[model samples]
Target: MRNVKLIIEYDGTKYNGWQRLGNTDNTIQAKLEGVLSKMTGENIEIIGSGRTDAGVHAYHQIANFKTHSMMSVYEMRDYCNQYLPQDIVVKEAVEVEERFHARYNATSKKYLYRIWTGRIPTVFHRKYTYYIPQRLNVEAMRKAASYLIGEHDFQAFSSVKSKKKSTVRKIYAIDIHKEDSELNILFHGNGFLHNMVRIIAGTLIEVGLGKMKAEEIPEILEGKIRAQAGITAPAQGLFLYEVHYGE
Candidate 1:
């Protein structure tokens, strides 16, 4: 068997999420698997680096699959893209070692959250950003974000319904950047729990709007209670920027 690795990018607006559902084919994973399965004339199970939530986008998601087909790497990539939906694309595909597991071998992941703080409506890319008409203090948001760096038990930052075995994840850095009316928040971490980034974005928004003080972020982290954090930001605003492997 040959281990085939693929770099995928998708707009998750019309899909249920990245994972294949029990009774639904409306997922990025399922779509890719179905096409590959048909093309190779064998069952293909692709393992993704992470499961992106419903309506979230991805720029460079990684996945791997084992197959017996003799198709070349470039052929596989082009064939898959020819059949996959326009919103989803296979940017690269290559043969890899059999031991390379996409999820387990991942070293770090980066996520980006886009916020539109303009008073006027965003006409072109409204679906790609969170719209907030009011002014936000970027400095306050930056101060609140500093508390999120380093390793910590992020129970308060995750959803109560998340089924993770542990919530202790290391956040390497959290950065907030503003360009005109658009604000971008970047998070680099070892891993992220369900809804963790969204919750952090919500908490920072509160600080930016003066609803909460920047110094209160540590208290929220220490509380370790989901209710102590702010609301979960909308899924559309979040994007899986990249996943890193090895050193």
Candidate 2:
């Protein structure tokens, strides 16, 4: 048996999420497994690096599965692409060690949240970016984001329904970049709880809008209450940029 690592990109508009639910009719994992089973004539289980919430897209999400097939990596990619939907694409595939598990072996993950601060909604970018009509003070947002960089108990930023026991996570970086009306926030972290990044983005936007002070971030973090944070931004504006694994 050989383990095959796949680099996948999906629009994530129609599917429920990355993971397969017994009752859910559609999912990214189920689709991939269906095509793989058809091609290999064997039932295959594909494990993803992480689960992206419904409507959250991915640029380079990784997954790995074990298979015993005579097909080459190049041929497997072609075969999978032919069977996969247009919104989902298998960008690349390669054989890896048998013990390599996508989720367990992942070192870090990078996510990007796009925001459009303009008077009118952008027709072309409406699907990918969150449109906020108010003029955001980017400098204030930057100052607020600084407090989030480093290891901290992020209970205030996580969703109330998160099942994770410990909310402490290390944020390696929090970067805010702007180009005209478009604003992008990139977050690099060891891991994130449910809706953590979205809540952080929403809280930062509040600071940018002058609703919250930059100095208030530390207080919120210390509060450890989910209600202390801002709204959870829509998942449509977020993307799983990439997952890292140490070689």
Candidate 3:
């Protein structure tokens, strides 16, 4: 068997999410797998680096599959793009060592959240960004975000209810950039729990809007109560920016 790795990009507006659902074919993984199976004439199951929520977008999602087919990596990439929906594209594919598992071997993941602070939403970007008409205190948001860096149990900032899985994850950085009316928040982390980035974005937004103080972050982190955090930001505003496997 040959291990083939693929770099994928998708606009998740029409899909349920990245994971394949048994009841429906409306998912990124299902679409990719279906096309690959047909291209190679064998059952193909691709393991994604992460599961992005519905309406989230991805710029460079990584996935890999093991197959017995002798198709070239270039041909595999082209075949996938030719049959898959236009919103999803296979940017690159390469044969790799059999031990290279996409999800397990991933070193880090970066997520981006876009916020439009303009008085009126931009027509073309409306589907990709969250629009907030009022002004926000970016400095306050920055101050609050600093507290989130480093390893910590993020139970308060996620929607996941199960305590079985440890919520301890390391956030490498939280960089917020503002240009004109657009605010881009980039989060680099080892891994994230369900809805963690969205919740963090919402919490920072609240701090920016003066609804929450920057100093309250420590207490929230220690509280470990989901209700203590801000609302979960809309899925459309979030994007899986990149997956890092290290050089």
Candidate 4:
């Protein structure tokens, strides 16, 4: 068997999410597996680097699968792009070592959230960016994000319910950039809990809007109370920008 690594890009507007659900076939993993299984004449299941919530897009989602087919990686890429939905594309494919596992081998991930601060939202980017009418205090948001840029117990900032799984995650950096009416927040981290980045984004947004003070971040982190955090930002604004394998 040959281990094949794939770089995938998708618009998550219509899909349920990245993971395959037993009850539904409207998921990114299900779609890819169906195509690959058909292509390879084998029961092909892919391992994604991580899951993206519904309506959360991905620019460079990484995945890998084991196959017995003799097809070249280029051929596999073209074939997948041909059969996959227009919104989902396999940008690249390459053969890798048999031991390579997409999720386990991933070292870090980068996620980007886009906020539109203009009163009138752009027609093209309406589906991609979160629209906020009022101006945001970018400096305040940055100051608030500073508190999040280190190892911490992020139990308050996630929607994860499993008691056994650890909620501690290290955020390498939280970068906020403003260009005209668009504000981009990029998060680099070792890993994230369910809805962690979105919740963090929402809290920072509250700080930007003056609803929450920048000084309150430490308190929220210490409280470890989910209710103390801000709303979970909408999924459309979140994007799985990149996955790093340390190669």
In candidate 1, what are the lDDT values of residues 1-247, reduced to their tens digit? 9999999999999999999999999999999999999989999999999999899999999999999999999999999999999999999998999999999999999999999998997887687899999999999999989998999989999985756588899999998899998999999999999999999999999889988898988888899999988889998999999999998
TM-score of each: 0.97, 0.97, 0.98, 0.99
Ranking by TM-score: 4, 3, 1, 2
lDDT for 234 (candidate 2): 90
**TM-score, candidate number 1:** 0.97
How far residue 118's Cα lies from its native spot in candidate 1, in Å, is: 1.4
User: In model 4, what are the clashing residue pairs, if there are any?
Assistant: none
lDDT of 3: 0.95
* Ten-residue stretch with the least lDDT total in model 1: 159-168
Give the count of colliding residue pairs in each prediction.
0, 0, 0, 0
C-alpha lDDT of all candidate models, in order: 0.94, 0.93, 0.95, 0.96
Output the lDDT of residue 56, model 4.
Answer: 95
lDDT of 4 by residue, 107-216 (tens): 99999999999889898888899999998999999999999999999999999899899999999999999998899999999999999999999999999999999999
Which residue pairs clash in candidate 3? Answer: none
Q: TM-score: which is higher, 1 or 3?
A: 3
Candidate 2, clashing residue pairs? none
Candidate 3 lDDT at 85 equals 97
Better of 2 and 3 by lDDT: 3
CA lDDT for candidate 1: 0.94
